[model samples]
Target chain A: MPNLRVHNLTVSLDGFAAGPRQRLEHPLGEGFEGLHEWMFAAMRDRADGKTGIDVEYVERSEENIGATIMGRNMFGPQRGPWQDESWKGWWGDNPPYHNDVFVHTHHLRPSLAMEGGTTFHFTDEPIETVLGRAYEAAAGKDVRIGGGPATIQQYLRAGLIDELHLAIVPELLGRGERLFDNLGDGIDGYRVAELVGSPAVTHARLVRR
Target chain B: MPNLRVHNLTVSLDGFAAGPRQRLEHPLGEGFEGLHEWMFAAMRDRADGKTGIDVEYVERSEENIGATIMGRNMFGPQRGPWQDESWKGWWGDNPPYHNDVFVHTHHLRPSLAMEGGTTFHFTDEPIETVLGRAYEAAAGKDVRIGGGPATIQQYLRAGLIDELHLAIVPELLGRGERLFDNLGDGIDGYRVAELVGSPAVTHARLVRR
Candidate 1:
């Protein structure tokens, strides 16, 4: 069976997946620019990046992902009702994801076809329904859960995630959207399968037990 | 000045220092037994443990400490007025801390000197005042902050802690006392000095900037 994997989900030492008060100006919220420094550094040194574990994990997040599911917050900085449909997302015409992308939101929007193969379908349906659509769109390939914390938490709480790869950045956001809150019994079904560290961050992979 | 350092403070992937509903039977709190597995494993293989990073960190926590300061919770499982002072602490007779130990509490009690050089002094003084006493007792050696999450949070909020070494365990304690909660801007003063991982856990050293 194809896996429902969450990868390269960076969180602070305090467990904040994203800094608080995410806005149009600061998409990841304030004091979180440094959170993805490891990934940026790895991408910068692309030639020698493969030699480093940090880069390897960053690259691994994109592998074998046929479809992606993300929250509307991740889709754009827009909140509540959409101001306009003009916002084409943070990524330009050709987003990194070249497959069908499902955006979880309360406000419905028509399907958007972007440059390349990426298409955005907004839905307010239950997580299971969206996941089913994502899997169908994936066509036997693994489904990637692109997160903004809330979206990932939804999947995690539902125990739908097959694997979770977290890059724990050694920084304290103090106040932010925490990745591992209110998990209840949903977390009991998983165990840490792999743990490794690079100079920049510690990578922990949790698999469903 | 004697530096205030925190060592071997193990937290779950969700950043919980201790699980919820701590009591005598569940010292580290419920579902938190696995949090300290790395430390226990490292200690079990004492002869050859020095080669591993986990063991090295475990040993490092014990070195260069003159006095220890902990909250009431770390000292005993008793709550509110001590209940006759029959409890000397979890560690009987010759306790692990063989030095002047200060226990921060609301209810005052007479100082109790135990086996080995360990002496427990209960004080209702402020954090700064207690820290001053701890520093004086240290006699120029570093003072270790023995935590129960709340204790560490107090020290952290005041920026009194000089160094914090956290063992990031790869597990989830759904509900518990979070170490990094309500820190406000207190977390900004610290930066990750070193990060290393073993098979069991990842150790992160944060030093005041």
Candidate 2:
């Protein structure tokens, strides 16, 4: 099986995985850009010409991600009657998920081919189908649990995810979509394999028992 | 204001909000209990409890919270089909919200009465209307943008949430729902007012500018 893992995801200290007003302009909310400062600080980001440790880490975290799964919103802000699916995603020419992506939606559409290797596969086939497809696409590499909360919860309920990652930012929106509200029991058996600390991000790895 | 912050939120190094298999019984998911030991640690849990360093601050966060909002899932785990409003919530006799709770659902039903002075109002009303009612109920107090990720996303898209309290558990369901998959910018222009460490939870406060 492709080792399921979320490389680096940043969250607000207040429990918000993302910021308020998820718009094309304000993708991460008002003050969330700083949450991934740790990623920039990593040596990997620096190697990519990212100044400061923070930029370096951010660059590095995106590496080796074979495949991804995301909700429609993560792709863009098009809502309520998607206005005819013209909205590709928030990403301009090239989306971050350059390889392949499985998007969950009610509308049944065919796979969308983007400029880069990213191909948006709209699956009304249900969560398990998406997961199975994602796992297979990963080809025994690393599969990122790209989120929007609902998608993550589905996997959580099914117990398919293998590893988790969180980059804690020092801020709060006080009230917004919380990461865990109706969440069922999380993965029952797993151990923290590693814990790397920094001013911006605290990276860790979880291993299944 | 009664502060309803996430004092016990735990996150895995991988960035999963909570583990998979979300349910009434395993609210946090399996094995996830261990990942959040930091929050359950003596020091932090006490802080969110009736008394501690931020004792006075406790509940004060919710002071502005005149009314609360929640999704049907947060209201109950009745899945598959609505069938009937036969099932209640997992909270048992009393739920956490002692005030008005606006539950978002398509099913039309009368508001429910619960212990601890909590009332459940079911509505298909738009978030603004619900939030207006909650704000009115809050009467200058902060309104809590409650969840089921969908509910929170609605509020976030509206930019209604002022604060957030999240706990990141140290486990991964590799294939569960995610909180921030589609959040355009996520959180930006925020500050981490506090970072409380513990074994069970790590509570943090996020304030938006």
Candidate 3:
């Protein structure tokens, strides 16, 4: 089964996912940059830089991605009628999402063909429809729910997810949108399947019952 | 001068702000509990004890936050049809947004009030109009545009911001939302006024031209 998973999200000790008043030029928010150092170092240059992090974690975490679900805002920081579609997907000629991709939006625009294997499907269909599309696109591989928080919350509430992997960076975003403000109390059963603690941050995997 | 600043926001190198498929129960989306080692460590030691993150960052970031703006999805994953008027703003007894919050929605709803200083003002208003209202409600303090992604991009494109701070955590969502995905051109002339390479991430100031 291509499990529905929410993986690799970041948050502050104070429980913020992103800061308040996020702007296009700066998406997170001021002073909130401290929330994400762990990822940059891991991707850019691991301290070891070689035989770093357990192979299983890296494979199941980083290189394991199959298809992506990008919310409209994640596509760009624009509002009301895109500016001439001049905005290609955020990544350059080769976007980070190389497999099939689905964009969630009410705007019925044509699919965008990017330079690489990435093509964006704009859907007015229900989220379940999108999830199914992405899953089929994944072809028995796992489907990653690329979130803006709200997107993830919707799926989580629908009980559509299976696993959640996190790279626990050490930091705090005092304020902004929180990943778990109104959450909890509803999630009844989950078992911690894996845990990795490093100097920069910890990594853990949570699987639903 | 109106400073185009990126304040209090954080990002991982892989550029996934929040985890994928966020929900009310697991708001941070799967394993996000790993992201807040510092905060959790501090708060965890003693259930109801105070943390060292400072009252200013905590109170100002969450308490004094005058107003907020979020994408429609950010407000609730549900779309179309009034499921229940009971879905007051996402936060409960004390939502992070304690003042007036203008939600951007094509589908409109009446203004909502919560326990704390939070109010949900559904606006079909333009992004600028929402910003103006939010700024006014903030009364020269600061207004936070909580991210769904597109909400923040609109402000940046309009050049209506002052400061932006980013916390770069280490992790690869490989997919999900990219905070800077569709930004047009370089914000140009912006300089780093402050930078923190410690505390697990790099916190930097982005000042306008």
lDDT of each: 0.88, 0.62, 0.61
Question: Over the stretch B66-153, how does candidate 3's per-residue lDDT look in tens digits?
Answer: 5677777678766677677777655566776667878898888888877677888888888778888877877766677776656666
**What tens digits encode model 2's per-residue C-alpha lDDT throughout A1-209?**
46666656666554567767777776765545666555545656567665753554456557667878887766667655566867777676677678789887776567888887898888677777777788788776676777776676677556677766655666555545555444554555556665444545444455566
Residue A48 accuracy (lDDT) in model 1:
57
TM-score: model 1 vs. ground truth:
0.96
List candidate 3 segments past 4 Å from native.
A46-49, A54-58, A182-186, B1-209
In model 2, the Cα lDDT at residue A125 comes to 77
Per-residue alpha-carbon lDDT of candidate 2 for residues B1-209, written as tens digits (9 for 90 to 100): 43222222334534455557767776655434565454335446566454543333344444546677877766775555577776666676698778888888887687788999888888888877987787777676656755656666566545556666555444444444455444444444445555543333345555555
Q: Candidate 1 at residue A10, lDDT? A: 92
The DockQ for candidate 3, computed on C-alphas, is 0.03
lDDT tens digits, residues B1-209, model 1? 67999999999877789988889899989999877878888887776635688778878888889999999999888889867877898999999999999999998889999999999999999999999988899898999998989999889988989999999887867788988887878888888888888878889898988
DockQ of each: 0.73, 0.12, 0.03
Q: Using DockQ as the measure, which candidate wins?
A: 1
| Tens-digit lDDT string for candidate 1 (A88-194) | 88999999899999999999989999999999999999999999999999999999998989899889988999999999887877788888886778988888888
Q: In model 1, which regions exceed 4 Å deviation?
A: A46-49, B47-49
| Among all candidates shown, the one with the greatest TM-score | 1
